[model samples]
Target: MYRSHTCGELRISHIGNTVTLAGWVQTVRKFGSITFVDLRDRYGITQLLFGEELNKQLDENPLGREFVVQATGKVNERSSKNANIPTGDIELLVESFSILNKSAVPPFTIQDDTDGGDDLRMKYRFLDLRRNAVKKNLELRYAVNRSARNYLHENNFMDIETPFLIKSTPEGARDFVVPSRMNPGQFYALPQSPQTFKQLLMVSGYDRYYQIVKCFRDEDLRADRQPEFTQIDCEMCFVEQEDILNMFEGLIKRIFKDVKGIDYTEAVERMTWEEAMWQYGNDKPDIRFGMKLCNLKFPAHTFPAKESLSSLIAGDFAVFNDAETVIAIAVPGCAEYTRKQTDELTEWVKRPQIGMKGLVFIKCNADGTYKSSVDKFYSEEKLKAIADAAGAKAGDLVLILAGTEERTRKATSELRLEMGKRLGLRKADEFKLLWVLDFPLFEFALEDQDGGGAGRWVARHHPFTSPKPAHIETMINNSPKVADLDKYLEHPYAGIKANAYDMVLNGNEIGGGSIRIFQRELQEKMFAALGMDAEEQQHKFGFLLGAFEYGAPPHGGIAFGFDRLCSILGGSESIRDFIAFPKNNSGRDVMLDAPSEIAEKQFDELSIKLNLK
Candidate 1:
């Protein structure tokens, strides 16, 4: 019962109304004996005036920053109004007040524009939460949750609770294990996602299910990734891929409308995985710009004349001749690039991760002149012909990368980003959504393949995905061929498309899911194709297999990265800004200093050994 009305709820209409309000001291302005203290709370701020009458009390008990106080005052209109704040036109004429709580001096300023670094802010997160920017972010996160929940509830989806400490099965990421003290030497893993449980819910005849749940992944972190994150997980039974897609699309549209007030009327564009890779050199392509890499050495097309080759491809450029794939990128209107600029581009490709041997360039000059790194190899006619083939006009530059397939693709992606920066194409506010579908059913990891990939076909998506109808016969036909040493599994796994789809937003994969195989025989086939023997399958996923036996419905769903989605909606690149308490790059909770070792007694009870290297 600190106050009747909130600081933000007062306005000119409440003038002459006696009220009591309490908040932390934001700022204090003094001119001679008259004093004004800005009292702040989560709602807003109000200026409290202490006249000569209360001057002795105010002077004796000085008001410092962040001191929580209770003040009973009469609300009055301000003589000089502030146009900036909502309560600008009003001030409180204090009748009486008392200090409730005092705070020690904070480590950093609690203003919206405080010049505090990430580490400092994270360490003093309690103080940081008082900043207006952080407050707004937290409020926006709440709004997102509300909008999502409202939408789901209105659409007949239940907000179900899933267990966190569940049995561990390997997904793509590493599990965070929790030791069970009650059961010695046994452990329970924090769920990466409620994948199995949600599927079980579908078997229990819950047609639509959703959860705003925490998921854990003990993996290396990136700018967009965290060790622990939240997902707006959802699943629906007896629905096709189209139904799931449309439902989620509606949810996204509703969120945008409710939170951002922007109408995304256009239907989300769809592109096959092959098309995305071929056109943008990435499955999650940023479609805002178009400097698409064109394959120059495609065997389908006839070789261009020597005039085209003379630029770089013409003569004895052994790199291009020896390359399995030759790729080129067009830089619009950069034909007059200096030697230093050209060298910078060359150095960019030679980064350790990209691993390109070198970058070759053909600068198409005005007046029909040309300059190139490989000018020695190509004659003028060949250079012009090559420029023509690249569709490079005068004042354009064509960069070519020639190397092994892997190196060339990586280099091409990096080069695209560079050109994107130059062209001012990667705008943060502008969003481009694309659906990338038709991913391969299996991938050949070299180490896993060394084990003869026996029974072990790695999921290109996941083992739950249903193979495309056209590839079912092919998969069955080749299943046993690999078992026989005399024969080979000649059926290309790359061509086998899974019933999978990924939603990409501005080059980040926002969400992905696939139509799951419901039939037990199909599930067994999928496991066997991944090289899982009957015993191994039963041991790892015996519960799921048993659940399928009790009349499971065909189900599929997608989980949106709620943090990342909110970050994008809040106009920030990093998800850390949207999350309330985020960990550092190395996954340390700076505030709590988590992951500290426990006492020996606790470890003994759990039967865990701490073997520090």
Candidate 2:
């Protein structure tokens, strides 16, 4: 046998037992004639003590970091016990040892606090994985995986396999296509999710089905996104929106209990998409701390009934007068910010990411007086009114941004998050769950590639999502064409809500799903609304459309982003730490040096030619 016990398995209770251990040498230290080595394996680390003879053997063949070795030793209590490790109270007095393999010096230190840059660490990912930090993340990921599988199995969800290569029906993101060698002049796109297949499973009378599946998207990359990722894709038949919500809520809570030992007893909060946007300016708002958006001069059309304080700065300030909308957030206990600090904040907003001309602030002083950047244009009373409108209290600072509707709202949201970060409000350990519901069924695309949209509708979530029960008639009756571009929001299609829900943790969208359109007529109308005619519908989703004829039951399901969920649970800002071999931000595998040139003969076999423009 390679070993009688693992490096981390022995303890003081086994002090008299002789054991054989095999692992990599984490560190080697020598004092006079005795040597100490920390042997590390997947389990844990155990210290080893070598006598004079073995220390002389070490001189002939020195033990280095990350050398594979096997040692037979008598377990003994340590003279210097390491309180940090579980196997610290005891050490192995090595009787004999053999060096199985010697390793070249690692590019980076294999420890918790390593001396390596991101690119260097990524290049040597195998060594990076040996770090305690990375190992814990992967362990947590595995634990979450087991928890999810156990929960799903207990709840009667069957694990099913789905296709990787499928038809490309691009929606929000582009597809990563693969050329088919057998079918020349054509290509297959990787499944973005097992969306349609899971729906087909429901049609196949598999009421409960699930897959921890791989999905690909040719999209912009970010901290939370990947070109290829995993999803806990699931579907169910004979279920309603409420049923799906309750079931998945239980699954998430179970995951918390099983993996993190957190009860998560509090109910997951809920908000309409409109409410989320209006109150926080983000669909996935971080609810750990609240600095809700305050609308002052918003466009009347977006929130027609939303009260506005536009008149507060209407008269003399050209900045307020010329701007389309004004939005603000109150930062608690920041009223004493000096002029330089506020100027730095102004410069912060003007950065390219924020894309704002400047920033305005109202200091709600403790002495019942208001000081503001726009004091020249408005009286002290007007300033106090604006501050009060934003729910700013005494000693609170109200930060305001004004611009066109979309940019200003987004900028205000970014500003709120920055202030929260600065004040240590967005705590990593404090998780909050939210369900943002009632998203608009169709988003109006200004103009689509096939000369269709500006004038046409696109699915807000996906084409198959069912409209709200009350909005079904409106969706079927309306033409979905925008005769007047400026007044597109006035269309009845604009008001129709989807039966979709997104599960938000902290500030990230970790899962989303919708009740599907099960009726043929309604499905057809949804296709037409998305600028897909009968011929295009047949070409794209013909199989799904035909499945509806075979007694497809009412169904709904959700897919959790497996990576994002793991990252959030692991208290990480980036999903890369949880993923085993994640691509860098630009979607390149630096270790493998992938996305390289393929063989010309292979391209010829697929009858493809590259026009590298």
Candidate 3:
């Protein structure tokens, strides 16, 4: 055997025991004739001592950092014990040693806080994974995976594998296609999610099904996004929205307890989509801190029954007057901001991404006086009314953004998150979960596919989602066509809600699902509403529609972004850290140099031509 015990196994209890150990050299130090070396493996590290005689051997055949070696030694108690490591109290006094393998110096030091940049580390990811921090992330990911499997198995959910290659039916994001050599001029698109297959399984009488599956989408990349990612996908039949909420809620809470040792026993908070937009300006609201958006002016159609506080900011101010909406958030304890600091905030809102003309602020001083940029247009009483409308307290700063309804609401949400981060309110250790329900069943996107002058109605979730029972009648009765372009929101279809729900944790959408349309008539109507004609729907989703005609039961399911979950649990912003051999931001495998060109012969076999634009 190369070793009797791991490099990290010998302890004070094993003192005087002769053992063989093998590992990579971590660090080497010399004290006159005596030499010390730290040996590391996957488990942990242990220090080794080379006496005067053995030091001579090391001097002749020196063991460098990351050199694989084996050593036979007596476990002796250390003269000076290190309180940090587990085996610090014992040192292996080496009698003999052999070099197993030698390594060229790594491009980066394999330390928790390495000196290498991102590209260098990615290029040497195998070396990077040896670092303690990265190892911990992978360990956490495995724990979460094991925890999820245990929870689902206990709940009678079967792990079912699905096909990776499927017909390309464009739903939201673009699909990554694989050319078929067997059939020229044909291709297969990767499964974005096992949506149709899971539904089919339910129709075929598999009540509970799941897969820790890989999903792909050809989309823009960012810190949280990856082209190919994993999901904890699940589906269940003969269930309502309530059943899905309870089942998947249990999964997440169990992951928290099993992986993070967090109890999370409290009930998760719930809100409607309208209420979320009205209160926080976003569906995924981080409830760790309460800096809810105050809608001073907004369109009635957007928040149909929501109370309007537009009268509070009604004045001679043209910015507020001309704006489609006015929104504000009262950031606590920022009333003492200097003019320069406030101007900096103004410029921040004016950035191209934010696309705001300017920012308006109201500083509620501790002495109960109000100071505002728009004070010229409004009196002290008027300014106080606006502050009161925004729920501002003494020593609070109210930041306002005004423009089009969509832009203003989105900008306000961004500002709220930014402020929360600045104030250290978005803590990594703390977790809060919420369920936002009753999303608009369909959204009107500006797609001129039919040469329609304005836009068209697309399914907000997917074509398979069922409309809310009350809203189904209106959907079937009214035409999806808009009579007036400016008044699209006035259509009855815009008022319809889906039987869908999204689970949000700490301002990130972790999972979502909807009760599916099982009846052929309703499913066809949904397809039609998405502008798919009979022939087109038949070509893309005829199989699914046909399956619905065969006594399909009511079903719903949820898919949690497994990578995002691991990253969140590991207190990381980027999912790549939790993933092994992950592609870089441009979706290129730097280590393997993938997504490269294939041989011309291979392309000819597939009968494809590269027409670079």
On lDDT, the leading prediction is 2
On residues 281-368, what C-alpha lDDT tens digit does candidate 2 reach at each position?
9899999997899988877766667666887767878888888888989999999999999999999999999999999999999998
- Name the Cα RMSD for model 1: 3.6
Q: Per-residue lDDT for 523 in model 1?
A: 84
lDDT of candidate 1 over 28-72, digit per residue (tens): 898777899999999999999998888678889898899999999
Off by over 4 Å in 1: 298-314, 365-369, 384-394, 448-456, 480-490
| Model 2 vs. true fold: TM | 0.98
In model 2, what are the clashing residue pairs, if there are any?
A: 446-454
Candidate 1 vs. true structure, TM-score: 0.92
Superposed on all Cα atoms, the candidates' RMSDs to the truth, in angstroms, are 3.6, 1.3, 1.7
The positional error of residue 517 in candidate 2, measured at the CA in angstroms, is 0.6
Greater-lDDT candidate between 1 and 3: 3
Pick by TM-score: 1 or 3, better one: 3
Question: What are the lDDT scores of the predictions, listed in order?
Answer: 0.83, 0.91, 0.91
TM-score of every candidate relative to the true structure: 0.92, 0.98, 0.97
Stronger candidate by lDDT (2 vs 3): 2
> Deviation in angstroms for 42 in model 2?
0.9
